[model samples]
Target chain A: MRIRSTLTFVVAAVAALGIVTPAAHADSTPTVRELLDKCDNGTDSCVFHPSSRTEFGGARHQVGRNANNCSTVNQNESIAWSDTTGGSNSIGITITAEYKFGEEFSVAVSATYEHTWTWSHTVTRTDTLTTPPWSVGQIFHAPQMQRVTGTYELHFGKKFYGHYYWYVNNFSATGPEDTDDAVTFFTRAMTGDERNRCPKSVSTAKEFVSTESTPAQPALVASVRPGD
Target chain B: MRRTVATLIALVAGLAICTPATASAAPATHCTLRLETGVVTCGARLAAVTNNDVIIGRVFDDQNYGGSSFTITGSHPCKNGNGRDFGVQLAKYGWANRISSLQAWGNCWLNLYSGPNYNGDHDGEFKADTPYVGPLMDKRTQSIGFD
Candidate 1:
């Protein structure tokens, strides 16, 4: 049935400002650390923007690992991870809080993106409305996918593009092909609770300065560069 | 001829991998789980779902969505386009909502996606014959078997 219970964007973001009880809202895992230091995983850190785990409604997915093979993608898919000790072959993604704008670290992140040949567009844009946001977010998500309804509170995070060869990536947006086999099979990861769902991320080092009242249509919001 | 033989081999292999050969099955029992089609807020999670002690191989009327009914057709495995099987959960069907975890005559597989029910949408096919392996809730009463 349509389980309309779970938290969404603005609600999740507002939760972040209150007493951080990630344990309750978080999907059965330790997420506090994920919010504080997202880069702990280094350059290979991950972000699953469009996930099969339907945490939203109706056939809502369970909080833990979705160890099911996706017929659509023709690959073994999973967004959850194991809690065991030794290093795992699996790669995991987590959503965390966003903070710290344009600092030395931000400069470093920006510089890293520059080195990656894929990134071409300027960080700042003139307009700012929103686009139709046609990604996996649109494909399988049960309820309608709102590109820029001003509901989502994305912090510093972006999508995890490359393999686990590094920690979290410099950029954070992704597409279907952006993922690799190593990460496609990852498990055992933790992102904080509803309060701090927007974990700090290095996706966009600088605040995307909008020129004026006329914002970039959500469609103009280009996706992030894949790898570091 | 060759293709049919290959299919047979694959089917047997999948069963061996999914279930224990010597394991005692609970004897083809039929069960159903129900959930509310409402919003989950302020503590009201999954309402309740009870099992109606039915036997194996015998299909029953799936009354999951309050009233709308559908006969359980069959069950199968979760496979890629190429046909290699993986760790997947089985899916069964009733009427509006899909039925899963079917076991009769040692034959079972998950039914993929059907468009929508009265209230919700049936996602897609899941792995078949996979064990639920949920927590063990002891039955309150003991029973004597008929000779």
Candidate 2:
């Protein structure tokens, strides 16, 4: 009896103070803020690129093959940072559009060599295309290992009540962002004669892509409001 | 006794070398739809495939086109250039980011992306048989746009 009287007095006092306390229900509707918070906890219907809770630091590697003799070397080196969030997005907006990443960066022809025999002697030529941020005079010798650091970004999206919410979280990291090995060669340069004596032409290819691109749950829901 | 042991070792090594290796698994549920006859063929192999048929592309679960595979066929043949395009929603078919290798057909250029709706990290165009989709794109393919 005494505890009940105290509870009633407290309720009366709270009501007199004009503070409206939300009533608790077994099946209460979550607000927009609550839904967004669920995305942060990675427990709701949200999709994360790379992963919802992990750091990506893997590198993409390519190794040049051995040449027989009088060979040509051609290669395409590329590193791309893209979003992999997918689901039934009813809001008609792209998940990637909502979550931005670095970009699709590629080196069309990173290295090239040509060996031609005119009438008199064999003609040999080699060239390496260096784009911005790449140190000039960096050559990728034969039988060399070329590696490009992976890029990282955080992108996520969620669908709630026929609407969608997405965020990039303002967090991104490039393989070379804080490392000296943005693009590095593991082996030493081959001599001109050795390069010319390569057994066969060497062509190498490189690529970068998402580590994980699946959502934990589907992002589709009915169009009903909370209490309706 | 030593000679017998050596012969047994050699026999075991020869068996290991001559035994046929198991091929990688391909997607078992995916099928091919022939646009001309509307015939659906499941577990169709694209090896030695000709260009006369209306083919969209083939996605592999393993690199070098090994393992399980699936073919995509559309209503009409893919255009020579980029006239009309067919975008495969990989997630709808439960194939998002599961492709390690791919090949284009029907004179179409297979364009890969890491995201849905063809957004993010476009992996250029591939008209040749790509045994491996490079270090970056391997297993990162989410969608393929044929044009």
Candidate 3:
């Protein structure tokens, strides 16, 4: 009976002290700030190419020695960050449009990500396109420019744990014969210290040049029948 | 007994040598297109195809060249003589003038034509990762021959 009383007393004493064991720390994943540092420092693993263009069709003939130029510039920015959250991780993406080049205006952003656990896994992607308002005079005049900006916070599930990439498809303008150019600043999940280190613009300037030309008309040819 | 054993071994070895060896099969390259949504899926090792064969998908049947897509896998020069012509086979399966997109898997070039028998106006030359032949070639394609 005395031994039982002594054990009960010890249990009561421990409960009164509120002693609790702590959990093990989770693995460390690189933050958005760290990724920005790597990009600024020019690491081989995280390199940024400033300019890209996609020409849909070759230059063709137009009226009065005019030619069609169907090319658009694409600005891409990609950063890698780690996530220790067992659930979804959230990050903010901001696009500040500094200038514009041509007539029709639109902006598109695409985010691509992959899971590291599988082999030969295809990248999953999502895209959003927006067109700001423009006036008729701005569409016709030379050196037309506009400033636009946007911010978006994206939540990624735990399945997309390894690496993530965001692409800004800034189409400043489009026409039969036209030019589009713009400067966009991008920041995502940036902390106060990281914001100061991030570059103002993730891309460089691209220019489109065209010239007038004339071509001779094709001559008509008579068809030959099998029995003729 | 030793002589008999030696003869049996020799007979077994001869049989093994005489049997015809099976030819090594080529790895399959898969290209899947979701019709309703216009989504395309391609295999990972598309760049590893080293032959001159091109695979063209056609709708079961529809006259006015409505819905179709093509994928060319394997490494080959983008020229006439080097690549085999699958145009005849495609036309037989009701694929004439119905191509919608072209997917270049390997480092090869593809030429899209507007008429069958490789005649009429030429559309354009397409390379890797080009989603579709623009609006000009989208359902207006009558024939296609890869280089």
Candidate 4:
């Protein structure tokens, strides 16, 4: 009966052209906590930057002010800073989030950093008449040497879900006329007991798959004849 | 002259009975271990502990652990070489899973991990009086060092 109505109109036109193929809706990819919640919801596809600083004697010592906000996603959050003139600073901050899924498959990275600072300077001298022999205005109070440094870096590029780079560096120094408090509140309570023996957080996740799929190209008009 | 005062009274009676029996037989040179409650304490220094507790040596303080578990032998009680350095603070101060348990005395050797910096996930290498049970470090230990 007309070859059963032409094989039911050629299988309903190849099932309506595989239901309007567009690579079958591009297989909907995007996971890794939804691209780390779209880079922690800052949107615009994710990329953040933060900076801070405070100085003394050379001026520009605001000491504080650097809100810092990202709210966590692929995880990396915690920022802090404290200062008290001539020297006495405590800073511990770490923010890291790196993700690369597909395109070449898996890649997830994280790094954390923390630092404490203390610097002091104070000096006043004069009592010259051949080594403390006589006084022409004798003043003494000396203890000077202060230095503090901090740095954090994050760099992720090229389709691990696209580009990103972040860097933060903090600094402070004192000497020559000295200061006395270069880290002491009992040495910041012994660096808070060595930051309580480190390792607060560092995250990771991974996955990679591609085990062959390209064997359906041998059917290009392989055997069909009807009235021509 | 009366035999030199009888040889100085037998060398001051053998130095006062060998100096309090060697200072009551060794007291603290460093020791603080808490491998999940298998407690151990010894300090001639370092005692101010509370937050989970773990600090081995090299000038110590912050010590807490009075009982709930204790046993590490290789000669029952004698420390030196900075008592094999050790320290722990699994949570608070930024939180993270916290599980711990470990024991190693004498020649001392320990280096276990799960994270907290020694580059996590190694979980091995213990010596002498061994004993490291599961949760394989529950809460996932951050870092533990000794040699």
- Superposition error at B70 for model 4 (Å): 14
Model 4 reproduced share of reference interface contacts: 0.00
Show model 3 residue runs off by greater than 4 Å.
A1-228, B1-89
Question: DockQ numbers for every candidate?
Answer: 0.02, 0.01, 0.01, 0.00
Best-matching candidate per DockQ: 1
Ranking by TM-score: 2, 3, 4, 1
- lDDT, candidate 4, at A143: 36
On residues B5-117, what C-alpha lDDT tens digit does candidate 3 reach at each position? Answer: 11111212212221211233433222332221222344422211112221222221111211222232211122333453233213332345545544332223456666765
* Local accuracy of candidate 3 as per-residue lDDT tens digits, A103-208: 0012211101110111011212222211111100001112112222211111111111132221111212111212231112221222334323323341111122
Candidate maximizing lDDT: 2
Q: Candidate 1 chain A — worst ten consecutive residues by lDDT sum?
A: A144-153
Off by over 4 Å in 4: A1-136, A143-228, B1-31, B34-37, B40-45, B48-110, B115-120, B123-140, B143-147
Error at A36, model 2, angstroms: 61
Against the unseen true structure, what C-alpha lDDT does each candidate score?
Answer: 0.20, 0.35, 0.25, 0.26
Q: Which is the better candidate, 1 or 2, if ranked by TM-score?
A: 2
For all predicted structures, in order, the TM-scores are 0.13, 0.30, 0.24, 0.17
| Selected candidate, larger TM-score, 3 vs 4 | 3
